[model samples]
Target: MSKRVNRVAEQMKKELGDIIFQKVKDPRIGFVTVTDVEVTGDLQNATIFISVLGDDSDKEASLKGLNTAKGFIRAEIGKRIRLRVTPEIEFAFDESIAYGSRIESLLTQVNNESKE
Candidate 1:
């Protein structure tokens, strides 16, 4: 991604996070955090990675809810950002947080075993 696109993506991530937190009324979208945003070179589509704080079911439901509200979210973005084209929004579940936690758990186990 170009520097310009990167900048715009960062701004959109922040703004979208705020918008979801403040505007979205869906209960299924509990504790959703926008992890990252990747915009296509043409600015026609954006993939939004989000981390949800909950179990598997919660995460699944949140993803579904976000996908359902994609159009509304895109419209909201168009309203807030002064972009010539509002990128189509796509929600993706981000498991990096969970992966990190698993790594931490393994490290802790290794340390405990070594301490014996």
Candidate 2:
């Protein structure tokens, strides 16, 4: 990706995150954090990685809701960012938080066992 595209993607990620938090009235989208955005070389597609607060079910529901509102979100992005082509938005659940929690839990368990 070109430097320009990367900069635009970063800006879009911030603006879109704020818009979703303030404008999107979906209860399913709980405490969503936009982790990263990857725009395709052609600028025709963007994959947005998001982390949602809650268990697996909540995260699943949030992803579903975001997917359902893709068009609206895309339109909002188009409105907010003056770009030749508003990239098609793809919502992806970022599981790094969960993975980190799992690792922490394992480490804690090991430490406790060692202390016994």
Off by over 4 Å in 2: none
Per-residue lDDT tens digits for candidate 1, residues 36-112, read 99999988899999999989999999998888778888999999889999998888888898999999999999999
* RMSD of model 2 against the true structure: 1.4
Per-residue lDDT of 13 in model 2: 92
lDDT of each: 0.91, 0.90
Candidates' TM-scores? 0.96, 0.90
Candidate achieving the largest TM-score: 1
User: lDDT value for candidate 2?
Assistant: 0.90
lDDT score for residue 113 of model 1: 100
Over 1-116, each residue of candidate 2 has an lDDT whose tens digit, in order, gives 79988988998899888888988888888888999999998889999999998878988999988888888899999998989999999988887888999999999999999999
